[model samples]
Target: MDNEKVRLQLYMARCGVASRRKCEEIISQGRVSVNGSVVIQPGTKVDDDDRVTMDGRLIKPTRKNIYIALHKPSKFLCSNEDPDGRSLAIDLISPVIKQRLFNVGRLDYLTSGLIFFTNDGDFAKKMTHPSSHVEKEYVVTTKKEIPEELMENFKKGIYVGGEFFKMKSYKLNGTNSVNIVLEEGKNRELRKVFQSQNINVKKVHRIRIGNVKLTGINSGHFRHLSEREIKSLLRDSSSKNGKYNNKGNRHNIK
Candidate 1:
C-alpha cells in the first residue's frame, strides 16, 4: 500500500506557519486554501501533487527535515515575529539551517533554557501532543525558600488561577533553588504555579526534556539531535498508568 497523504495542518507546521493546533485554527478561519479553494477541515489530506496556499500565497513543502536543540538565551521571544520588534528565537539559529524550522514549544522572554526547533512535522506533532506526556525538567531559582508545606502542597497538586497545577516531581536542590518536572507545557506554568504559592521566581532554566539533557550545551548555541536520540524520543511517547515506560524500563522524568 502507498503511504497515506500527510494531514494539511502537519504540512502547514512543516512550512513554519505555526503549531499544528494553530494551523487548525487558521484553517477553520478560512485563511488556508488548497487548489484554489479554502480548507476548514483539520483532517484534510494533501499529497505531493497538491498545491497549497496560505493567505493567497503558495506554500511549498520543505524537502529537508532539520532538528536542533537551542540553548535559548533570555530576552528572546520564542516566535517568528514580535510587534514590539524584539529579537526572535529564529535569529539565534545559523542561516544555513534556519530556513523552515520552528520552535516546538515556547519559552518565556525572561526564561532561558533548552528549546527544540525542527522542520519535521511528524516528529513535532508526536513530541508536542498532550497524550505523548513528555517530561520537561526545569531548574528554578526562587527569591524565597520553598517551604516544606508548600512542597507537600505541590505533591498534592495545588489549584491556581482556576486550574489545578501539579508537578510530576519536585525537590529543593539548594537553599533557594528547586528542580521540578511537569508533563504539561502550559504558558508560564512554572512561574504562575510558584506565584500562586507566594514564591518569587528569580530564574527558570529548562534542564531536560524526556531523556534528552542540556549537558555541555552552552547558552546561545544549538546542536542538531542525532538519529538515535530521535528514535529514543519516539519510543518513549506512550504513558501507562501515569508512568512512562521505555523498553520495559520505567522512567518518570515527568
Candidate 2:
C-alpha cells in the first residue's frame, strides 16, 4: 500500500493560502478545519481522500498549476488588500490566474523587482525555507558611494535591531550602486543594513530569484515561468546542502 499523508499546513500552502509557517499560524488560530472539524495541530496529516477547509471555505485540490514571474513595481503591496487603498501585487497578475496564488516571499513596498507567485505550496516551502538557502541577488543604489569597508562589513555581517544580518556576497557595481546576494530574507533587511552604515538606499531591485531572472519583463508585467526555469529552481533549492548550482548562466542578471 502506498500510504502517504502530507502535513496539513503543507497542503494549505500548496493551495496558495500562505507560507507553511503562516499556514501553521492560521491553523493554530482555528482557521483551518478538516472534514468540518477544526484542526489546531500543525502536523496533522491528510491523505488524498481527506477534505480540507480554511476559514469555513472548502479547499479544492488543484491539478492545473500556475507559476508567475512578476516584475513587481514599487508602491504595490504584496498583500491581498490594503486599508489605504494602495494597489497590491495581485492586482497586476493576469485575471486568468484566478486560482489562489500568493507571493513566495516578500519585496518591500518601495522596492522594484522580480517576485515569484505560484499555486504550488510545496514549491513555495522549498524555496523560502531557511535551510534551502536559495540565494536572492539584488541591485541596490545608495545615497552615497558604498565604501570598501562597508562591503566587507556586509560580508562579515552587521547588527541590526539586535539581530546580526549578513550578505552572502557583495560587490561594487558602480560608484553609487552595489550588487548583493543574500541567503536570508528578513523584513526590509537590505534597507536596514544600509541604514546601519549611515547610507540611505535610493533604489532597490531584485534581479534574480533562484535560477530565474527578471530579464525583459517590464515593471508591473508578469508571465508564467518556463518549464526549464521551474525545474532549475527546484534543482537549486534541492542543492541547499551542496554547492551552489546555476553559477555561470548568462541570464543571472545581478
Candidate 3:
C-alpha cells in the first residue's frame, strides 16, 4: 500500500545497513538519499515505490533475518572495512553466510571472544542498549598476581582516564585468573582497568553473552542461533533477575 510509509532509519535498518540508531547517525551525516535528494532527517517517510540509496547504491529490505554466534579469534577486527588491510571478523563467516550482516556490539581487535552478527537491527539495539542489563562473561588472565583491591574497586566503580568502569560480578578463578561479568562491556574495558594498576593482562576471552554460551564452539567457528535461543535473548533484555522492568526504552519497527 502506498499509505504504508515507514521512518527512514527503520527502512535503512530493514535493509541490513545497521541498527536503527546507527542508521539515524548515517542519515544525519547525509549518507542516505530518497528519490535522488539527500535526506538527513531520520524521520523522513518512505514507501516501497520511493527509491532509497545508501552511499549511492540502492538498497531494499532483506527478506530474511539471520542471527549467528561466532567464536571470534584474537587480533581480528570487528568492522566491515579497515583501511590498513587488517583482518576483519566478518570475513570468517562471509564466504559461508553470503549476506550483509553487522556485529551486535564489539570486541576489541586484540580481544578474543564470542560475538554475534545479525541483520535484525532491533535485536542489535536491544542487546547493546545499557538498560537491557545483558550480562557478558569474560575470563581474564594476568601476568602478575591479581590485586586484592582490583575486584572491589572495579565492582564499586573505578575511574580510569576519566571514564567510569564497573563490573556486574567478579570471581577469582585462581591467583592470576578471574571471571568477570559486565553489563556495559565498554571498549577495552578490562585492559584499561588492569592497565590503571600497572597490571599486564595476558589474555581476555569472552565465554558468554546473556543465556548464550561458547562451550561447544571452537575458535573461528560460527553457528546459527536456534529459534528458542533468539527468543530467550529477547526475553532477557526485557526482564532481569526473574522480574520484569519497564525502565528500558524501545524503538518501534514499522
- Write one digit per residue (lDDT tens) for candidate 2, span 1-254: 03368898877776678778888999999988898899999999986678798988888556677899999999999987899999899889847677788888899999999999888877888888766678899999988988889778868877778877778897788889998988766898888888988999999999999788899999999989999998988887787634434443222111
Clashing pairs in 1: none
Off by over 4 Å in 3: 1-3, 240-254
1-254: candidate 1 lDDT, tens digit per residue: 03348899987877766678878998999998889988999899996678889989888777677779889988989987799999887888957574767788789999999999987667777787766777889999999987877767876677777877778878789778889888866778788877987899999999898888898889988888988888888788744323543444543221
Best by lDDT: 3
Candidate 2 off by > 4 Å: 1-4, 242-254
Shift in Å, residue 12, candidate 1: 2.9
Q: TM-score for model 3?
A: 0.92
Instruction: Please write out the lDDT profile of model 3 over residues 170-213, one tens digit for every residue.
Output: 99987999999998777898999999999999999999998999
Per-candidate TM vs. native? 0.87, 0.88, 0.92
Better of 1 and 2 by lDDT: 2
Clashing pairs in 3: none
TM-score for candidate 1? 0.87
User: Whose TM-score is greatest here?
Assistant: 3
